[model samples]
Target: MLRRVLVELRRPQTPAGLAARLGVEREVLEAMLASLERRGYAGLAYPESPTCGVSCRACSLKNLCPAAASEAPQSPPVWRLTALGEQFVESAAEGG
Candidate 1:
């Protein structure tokens, strides 16, 4: 389940979307996301348009993005891969 979540999150998607994709409850997926975040393997998507520079990656507001919910009907924040998360996916795909 963890690996599947990690790989699927390579692209940004709403939490609800992710849960549906994995056939899990939103709360279940959210707990996994939070765990991955604490381990530095995943992160929240930036609400605003991508900005240049490394600082943008570490912005305190990264987890508080409002634009994530701007989509029609509103939804939870999107999840995305971190450097570590990407590495994990690549290695898994390569059969590491």
Candidate 2:
């Protein structure tokens, strides 16, 4: 789950945003995000839009997600990949 979240976060996403995309519960998603944050794999980014309550609301990648529309509006804050996250994904993809 964390690996999947890392890949999605490479673009941008919130705990709720990812949950929506993955068809998972917000609580489950937030736990994954928190784990990523603790491991220095992700970080939060505030939304630029005044109407966007959650930072992930404005993410361009949301449209491509299967579960994007299912998530509730009040999902937790957005999370983005940290440098470590990027590296981890790349290495994992390379069979590291």
Q: What local distance difference test score does each model get?
A: 0.70, 0.66
Give per-residue CA lDDT, model 1, range 57-83, as digits (tens). Answer: 455444444434354233456677777
TM-score for each model: 0.71, 0.66
| Model 2 error, position 59 (Å) | 14
User: What pairs collide in candidate 1?
Assistant: none
Top-TM-score structure, candidate number:
1
TM-score of 1: 0.71
- For lDDT, the strongest prediction is 1
RMSD (CA, angstroms), candidate 1: 6.5
All-Cα superposition RMSD per candidate: 6.5, 6.7
